[model samples]
Target: MPSPLPSRASAAGPVPGRYDRFLILGAVCLAGLVLPLSFTAPPVAIPAIAAELGGSPVALNWMTNAFMLAFGSCLMAAGTLADTYGRKRVFSIGIVAYAIVSLLLALAPSLAVLNGLRIAQGVAAALALAGGNAALSQEFHGPARIRAFSLLGTAFGLGLAFGPSLAGWLVQTQGWRSVFLSSLAIALLATVFGVPRMRESRDPDAAGLDWRGSLSSTAMLALLTIGVLEAPERGWSDGWVIAALIGSAALLALFVRVETRAARPMLDLSLLKYPRFVGAQLLPIGTGFCYLALIIVLPVRLIGIHGLSALNAGLMMIALSAPMLVVPFLAAVLSHRIAAGTLCAAALLLAAAGLVWLGVEAAAGSVHGLIAPMLLIGAGSAVPWGLMDGLAISVVPKERAGMAAGVFGASRVSGEGIALAITAAALAGLLQLRLSSAIGVDGATLTQAAQRLATGDAARAQALLPQLDAAALVHSYDAAFAWLMYGLAGLTAAIAGVVFALLGDASAHEPAALAEPARDDRIELADEPAC
Candidate 1:
């Protein structure tokens, strides 16, 4: 039988109390903050940047996509590096690199320079983010681990939920350059505090870095991301799009084959053999789709259809995010008594109900109608997001914690990217059909108009004005929201079914598998007496 999980008091080791872990948590979370800040800051400053840089809407899209693509692709590589080298060393290096890149971004003279810096920043972010969960897994265990993990989830949630609003305000109060400078300062501080206090954690017995696996994975992700981003602008049938799809599939197939045969694989294919692990990984994929879809769809609906300013629209979306803060804590408390899978299923149901209410509200054309639904969705999402990491990592051995952490993080990021692509396709297709029918124009003409409008080419859109009407545009938006609602509902039902069917009893796994160890290996090494 496996041993029971260590309590919070024991998990802290010689640090004195549970509160001591907060400093380390803050340092780890600081690294994570950069990612959301970078992803969000550009949207607020896009118009100004375009005015100065003379780039089209596609150029601006690349600014964000480039970072996300690089960051997502590099995560597996970073994880391997952390496991082979020391986590603290890699994390600190990443922090320093991220800060330097942010400064470079602030001083970038042209769009090309900025795009290059964004990719560098993403590389740094991938290194830092890939090891965060492993650090926590090594440092804390049992109920303490649960609480610490919850706080980590809260930090990420707050970053996504509030990063854009903060960036918007910064752009308004200070220049766009201030955003990068501010993040740079935060990264520097994290490095300063983290270097002396943070201890290294990596299993010396782990396999060497999987270069082949990393390369194949990165190539696959880049091809896939580029294909999705381009598909909306280029026809799905375009040669370039088709080529990207084929290349991505081939690379991914190669990656799977490589992992299966590698002496020390980057991804442990055996994890999927367990039902709970599979369910845990899949739940995040589904939830990520719903979470990002609602986030993107709701804001666009509010700003474009209702004529609300960006700031106001972002604030309104807070109705959906505010409850996320509380639900995780509640879920943590509930997890002591109920199964993690059961809580996840319940959360999905609540989120689905919220989505349904949101659809009803949108169909009726009342902005105020969305508030309640947003709250429900927010509350529901909190628990599952908080619990997902724990669920995945719990099933693995302590020695393989870094591998588990790497895989879990990769799954969530990949899921978010795939979700974004799927949601974008659905919304774009629906918008085209509805607008074309309403405006009495062919689909091709309507798509051109929509593209012009999306790119902020008001003059061009006005010149083509006779081809489309205001009512038609509004109808197009309404149709997109309708599709989003249906997607969310279907996603929620699927999540519920998976949870109930696959994860009905959490106790099927050895209790020792669920419990934290007596001593944190990371802390033990850090506190060892010098020879």
Candidate 2:
């Protein structure tokens, strides 16, 4: 297993003598970069978008989660379609759809319309991500694949790092609408390059479709997401919340049954048997829950609570995002020399420690206190983000590349949305508990107050609950934050241990021999235990 090290390659690690892989990598990276832009940029513009479009607090939450939930729900189905049809075809279609949606975003007359389009954008995003990652995993081999994934990580990091800063500038210069246009420009650009440059690839043996599996998977994700998002507004005991939860469970069972019986399941259930692959998936879920939660929440905290302008609020995050931009390149360099598990575990430990520190200071509403913690968390997170992705995709053979990438992407995006929802719900419940004791507000009023605080709408919170002492409100916010940060920190730290213990050896994940398309007709791929 060690003899065919990634450093020693099948023709210098796939795409042997040609630079065509670089072009493909660039196209994919371009698409990957746009996602963080869409995610982070909107947070800065939310207040503006809400004001112009006249949305309720719930509408605002949907503005963000709608995209994520739709994307997450459709990812597996999109992967199957990619495998059955063609990666390039799907990728190009996604780019075009994304561009069209982004353009429509600027023209939407109401938040409801914008939210609907965002869901469409999410679907397009799923297609692009599945196709892009599958293409990279299939074409790049050995160290080159590692480098390719790392580069993709770097692109993602760059998007995360710069998105807020750019959005703040754009929102200040142009209208809030410019943020959508900015994203549109990128998508249109990706389409131009992707159409001609991308190589078409598909699984020749793929069955048509798993209709029941796809339908059930979508219902499961959508219902679970709906339940979590509503938990903050309506009590967990609310009839609809309870029904959504039950329906989600039932649908998940049905999805499992269908997948197990299908000739070609949307996802390979057998992949779950590998501890390393599951562990790799946990990376995205934990990261989505923790780091991204921080990104989404912190800017709002800085802007609304600390009285910083959006520009300054974003600038403060430079400590976090800046490290992310450079860390992936370093990770790519060290991948050959270090064990992936050891490196990722060690880095996450650093991140967890940082999160704990950040939580304590963040609760007190101190922007200055967050800088060091942000740097620590950023450094820890960037190293492993791409590596974990490589781990997930590497464990599956090229034929199932779309499925593997879809799984990885789903974990990350769904985890982010779910984690944020949970964090917001927990914060709201705790904040209300604290406030009820201190301020004596009724349950319904407190629910609204908590929702406002969760969304970083300090202005709306003050306007609604003017009788509450300002000092008491801040204290309650901090108290809720304290619980969230510490819990997430401990959880993240624990997962670090799992990484070391679970991902024992990655040589087992080496790619099966891939036939050079131009040179050989011989192709050998196993359907199971590729890891």
In order of appearance, the predictions have TM-scores of 0.89, 0.87
Model 2 agreement with the true structure over 264-286: per-residue lDDT tens digits:
89888976876766777777766
RMSD of 2: 5.2
List model 1 lDDT by residue over 96-148, tens digit each.
Answer: 88999999988988888898889999888887776666666666667777766
C-alpha RMSD of candidate 1: 4.1
Best by TM-score: 1
Candidate 1's C-alpha runs over 4 A off are: 1-19, 436-441, 449-468, 503-531
Cα lDDT computed for each candidate against the true fold:
0.71, 0.76
Error of 1 at 63 (Å): 1.2
Number of residue pairs clashing in candidate 1, backbone atoms closer than 3 angstroms, sequence gap of 3 or more or interchain = 3
What's the CA error at residue 67 for candidate 2, in Å? Answer: 1.8
Compared with the true structure, model 1 gives a TM-score of: 0.89
